[model samples]
Target: MARYIDAEKLKCSIDSETDSIFDWDMTIEELYYNLCKLIDDEPTADVQPVKRGTWENTNTPNQLRCSNCEIIHFIAQYPHGEINYCPNCGARMDGVLSE
Candidate 1:
């Protein structure tokens, strides 16, 4: 299993004691890039995208209902079966996916 840290947590974990280290602030993208480099040093686990669809298909419906925190992940092969989860609040999609 991969361990995913929030952006804020990642920023605080950086070491600033090196001689060449500077205090120049970095944007979220830059921080994320550096964080990825650090995380890449170890055997990284899979970090699922914050969007819908699988790794192969990037064109799937991924909208979620904020009131319930439910998401339509992917339609299952079976008639009514589908893979869904609430990535935002981390809840299960118990309701049927809408078209």
Candidate 2:
């Protein structure tokens, strides 16, 4: 699978093989969920795993993106919010099995 790291400042840490970028308050699960959402909107529907990454902000951002599909999903999952994605196809989880 082709992989690419897109975040500018964050990439530096990865290249250096350091954990500096991981010390932020964000959880791995949250990052994973966000990654799925960002890549969910790709036009190709490739259903392949793609690489997308982001840096931590002092203030938690409003949205997180899927790594593969590039679809925007809400950071806060609330009463009327749903942010889910398919591991196989990177499809947006619209409160359904295959949304």
Residue lDDT tens for model 1, 1-99:
546655544444455422223336766676667656765544444466453432222245533343343433343432353345444555454555343
Residue-by-residue lDDT tens digits, candidate 2, 1-99 = 554434553444344533433446779986666545444422332345533333122233675554445445555654444345533345544432111
The regions of model 2 sitting more than 4 angstroms off are: 1-23, 45-99
Per-model TM against the reference: 0.23, 0.22
The TM-score obtained by model 2 is: 0.22
Best by TM-score: 1
RMSD after CA superposition, every candidate: 12.6, 20.3
lDDT of each: 0.45, 0.45
Looking at candidate 2, what is the lDDT of residue 5?
Answer: 38
Q: Please give the range of 10 consecutive residues that has the lowest summed lDDT in model 2.
A: 51-60
Error of 2 at 94 (Å): 41
